[model samples]
Every structure is written in structure tokens, then in C-alpha cells.
Target: MSNVTTYKVTGMSCGHCEGAVSSELSEIEGVSAVQAAADTGLVTVTFTEEPDDEAVRAAVDEAGYELVGRA
Candidate 1:
């Protein structure tokens, strides 16, 4: 089964920021899909398995954004 999670991110101000975050998250081993919205500062990730939330947060942090919360 697929495991999907949505995170509320902050400090994304442009499409470049979204693209960076998307690229980072997409490179993760189990990540199947990633959608990052600059306008809403939301990131939705779909994984082949239950991916580590910390990894996701780390990816965002590496991309120069902040993961505020998850749902």
C-alpha cells in the first residue's frame, strides 16, 4: 500500500523554492511523488512505504524551508 503524508511548510516565497523542495523530496528512496506549493507552503508526499518523517523534514530543511507540521 502507498503511504501518503501532507506537511505544512513555511518560508517558501517562489517557484524556485518549491522546485528545490520537490527535487530534494523526490530523491528519497521510498518517495513516489511530491507536490510542493509555494503559495500555500504545503508539501504532499506519496511513498511506496511509510517514509521517515524526519527524513522528509530534513529534505525540506536542506532545501532551505521549514516543516511546520504534518497531517
Candidate 2:
């Protein structure tokens, strides 16, 4: 079964920001999908397995954003 997790992110202000976050998160293993909303600063990630929190944070960081925590 797939699991979904939502995270609060900072520094996203446009569609480009959303795409950047989604692209980085989508690279993680087991991640089946990612939806990032710059308007709300929320990122929803669907995966087949639980992802490591550190890895998630790193992905956001790589995209030039910060993962504020779960939403």
C-alpha cells in the first residue's frame, strides 16, 4: 500500500518553486508521487515505504528550501 506524508516547507513562492521541491522529492527511492503547493507551502509525498526524515530534509535543502516539519 502507498503511504502519504505532508510536510511544511519554506521558501517556495511560485510554480517553479513547487516543481523544484517535487522534482527533488521524487528522486528518493520508494517515492511514488509528490505534490508541492507554493501558495500553502505544503508538500505531499506518496511512497511505497516510509522515507527517512533526514533524507527528506536533504532533498528539500538541495532544492534550496527548508523542510519546516510535518504539516
Task: Please write out the lDDT profile of model 1 over residues 7-71, one tens digit for every residue.
Answer: 99999999899999999999899899999999988899999976688888899999999989795
lDDT of 2 by residue, 1-71 (tens): 99999999999999999999999999999999999999999999999987999999999999999999999
lDDT of 2 at 21: 94
TM-score for each prediction? 0.91, 0.98
Q: Model 1 compared with the native: what TM-score?
A: 0.91
Candidate 2 displacement at residue 64 in angstroms: 0.2
